[model samples]
Target chain A: MQKQKIIFISLFVLVIAYFGGSYLYKNWYTQNLDFMAKENTSVFIRPHSPIYGDANAKNYIIDFFDPACETCKAFHPFVESIMKKHPGKFKLVLRYAPFHTDSYYVVQMLEAAKFQGKYDETLNVLFKYQNRWASHHSPNISLIWAFLPEAGLDVEKLRDDMKKPEIDAIIKQDITDGKTLGVTKTPQFFVNGKPLIKFGYKELQELIESEL
Target chain B: MPPLQKTSNLAWNILFLCWLTATIATLGSLFFSEVMMFPPCIMCWYQRICMYPLVIIFFVALFPLDTKVVKYAQPFVFIGLFFAIYQNLLYYKILPESAQPCSQGVSCTSDYINWFGFLTIQMLSLIAFSIILILLLFFKRKAI
Candidate 1:
């Protein structure tokens, strides 16, 4: 009889915990969701921001990344996969957050590529060669220029474009925007103008899925 | 009452506590991932694999006050303890980031929640597992 009573009590406690935990987590989710969304204002998206997918797509995922960040480089493929998985349901908006000093140069190069319609290609090449050019402590920023030729980019034009004031302005504006949005790290994702309460690829995908 | 009966009663109490902690820990993990939408990393998944079964195991053992339940459940607690400790090491940066099994998306070193600057999801898991482990050890010592 005592054993049965203990078992009953144990089961009762477990049920209470399960329900109570769900309640507490739901409360945490909504509170943090609102706090996070407040910082992911539309101001984060500029008129000339680099983007992928249909412009008219109803859902947008804005990625704040640093070209030199290892985590950003690692997460790029997962982000791409998420977009591919959803098709026309989602669009990706790329914003540069040059957290590292060298990242500004890489962002400038990408912005310059926008003029030649090679923005996406250049961005891919940069990610591919990131280890060589974006490595910490001994980065070879010049190595990035070498890969441009193979991507069929006009090397001289890119160099000239990289020096343009407009490219500098774009990078500067993105930094200002990122700072306003409370982004202090690379690969920060905001889904449909809502910041991820937790940073993770699955979390980002699930958030997008929920919005969908 | 005989001393043996008294010790047996105390052992049952400790076992009950162990069961209770495991139940709460498992539910808490689910709540964070499902309701709160927090992504769990590879190490977190490993820890979950070790934790989730104890709820059923302990509940079965509880109905009969099976003393031998300790033999079955201790392995789970030990394995779970190993993972929880590893996760804490990674969380504290004592283990290098490159050593993390989370090669693809969510970083194992990522901090989802850090209460009071030191407490984290991994720390919570460690504490939970430690309590169950200590309770189980107490049960074994009493040999009820």
Candidate 2:
């Protein structure tokens, strides 16, 4: 009986050690966001403004997003609401990091609309119709064109820009930038060039408010 | 001679099952990505690292290799188990209150692929660990 009890105790200790060690390793490796921030080597819009960070603002929030990502789509409205509430206090730049092939076209289309100063409107429409057009199969280009009028851009100019090299370059640069920053997923944000430790709208808002 | 033959057969059976399960899970995940169009998160990549090796390891174990190979593999499986358990804990949110276990993407806890609400990468790891433990125990018993 005593030997059996000892065996049970040994097994229990091993189980505990296995679980405890695993937990520690996961937390330690995953929570280190500083490592990613250091790896960012993408070209910036200006000094200290990598794609999404504010160029001239003291407090900038940079969101690295993929146009076709479901998570990015889910997180868009919350970010939009924050931007609406704090316009000048927070400058928002949308950097395109295309994870899927479909996202590349979406980014290109959005950039094309920028030529007509309808970038923000086009972005909102893209986020809204992301699910519709983001697929491994061919997306409905007609639906994309339908939103051009709503975004206050001429359809012809938008179509022309979609096929432009400049738009492709812009999208490619964002991907290049994302790789440098160690951003592996969509909807990743940085506050004042520091990657936010916690995710969620409330956490992001708190970080922004604290910075201000 | 009879006992040795039985032991060899048991070992082969265990290795075959492990290989089959690992292969099915991996191929299924890839198919899901292609068909369902869900992008693999960072945690999924780590799980892949732990699982992919089993395909080769198990195949080798099924052959008549040195006892040293089995000894070497025993530790590797344990290491994989550790990572899998760590991943599962992060997924279940049992690690720490402020554990940001997954940088810049869908967290390990997100459960992008949860079969029957419990079959997760962690659960798979638990199964793998149990298999290794059982094999180790069997070997020790045989030695005795």
Candidate 3:
């Protein structure tokens, strides 16, 4: 009887521990959403001109992306490799449609870099350090400036451009275009004017070839 | 039968019921999170690693329902219990919390799924662990 009583007490203690631990964890998880979770958005973009079969031997592809989106980050390297492989054949347009709060800053910074002809450099830095800003309070602006010389852009000009309303307008236009095309997620792509519905390198290659 | 035998049988019965309940809840949580749009956090993934195998392991244990099967399952349940306890400690902040930092696209600590105010992924693991521990104690006497 005494042994049974001891066993019962142990079981009761275990149960209490389980419940107590669970409650505490759940509270922490929910409260930290600002730093952890990304908000959903409905946005799309339209290219400057109609993208169809390259009548002028130039093909345009636009990627509507959110910097903080995991899928977009994963897709970046592949897209970059494609550009490197077929450099002049493809003219890629990158549009920012922020899906999460932090993403907006990345988009704004990228636009500022574009103003100084350092778009590619800024993009590479952002994607490479994606994990840092996605998890932390905010990114280091000094890091962005440090990469300016490597990107072959003037640091002072890049900094000045960051404060311009024109950069904000461009970002806004991308969002407006994204909404028009019914884009509600990150990494939405367009070849010519038609949205690429399927994902994967094979399908994207096929679609690009068909347009070519 | 002697009193020892009766107690052993009762323990086994309770253990079986607890395992069944825990397994069912785990499958339910998976469906709720994966298919139902709730996302799982890092601790949640660890709990999943512990619970997912039990669905198959317990079903297999049910086939023979003998001492041999109990011996085989004992280690698995114990290992699972260890992980569950470890996770509970992490969640409760009793131990130092360490998670793979968030990358641009994937937040390691992101908690996308929460149920009933307190039912996080780690909580589910604790429930499963407790059930298995109780069952193990019950079967220990019988195996002896």
True contacts kept of each: 0.67, 0.00, 0.00
Tens digit of per-residue lDDT, candidate 2, span A1-212: 54335335644664565556555644553444445434542332323222332345556567888766777778777766776676656666667777664657777777777778777788778767666766543455556776657777898877788998866766777777766555665787876556655567788888777767
- What does candidate 1's lDDT look like per residue over B1-144, in tens digits? 459778777877787788788888988888777765567888889889989999889878866678999889988889989999988888888988788777765677777789999888889899999999988888887865
A100: Cα error in model 1, Å: 20
Question: Which ranges of candidate 1 are over 4 A from the true structure?
Answer: A1-28, A31-113, A117-212, B1-5, B93-105
Cα lDDT of model 3 by residue, B74-97, tens digit: 666677677667666666668665
Candidate 3 docks at the CAPRI level of: incorrect
Model 3 achieves a DockQ score of 0.05
By DockQ, the better pick of 1 and 3 is 1
Model 3, retained fraction of real contacts?
0.00
* TM-score to true structure, per model: 0.57, 0.52, 0.47
Model 3: residues with Cα > 4 Å off, grouped in runs: A1-109, A117-152, A159-212, B2-22, B25-42, B94-110, B141-144
Q: How badly does each model clash, as a count of residue pairs?
A: 0, 2, 12
Clashes of 3: 12
By TM-score, is 1 or 3 better?
1
Query: What iRMS does model 1 reach?
Result: 4.2
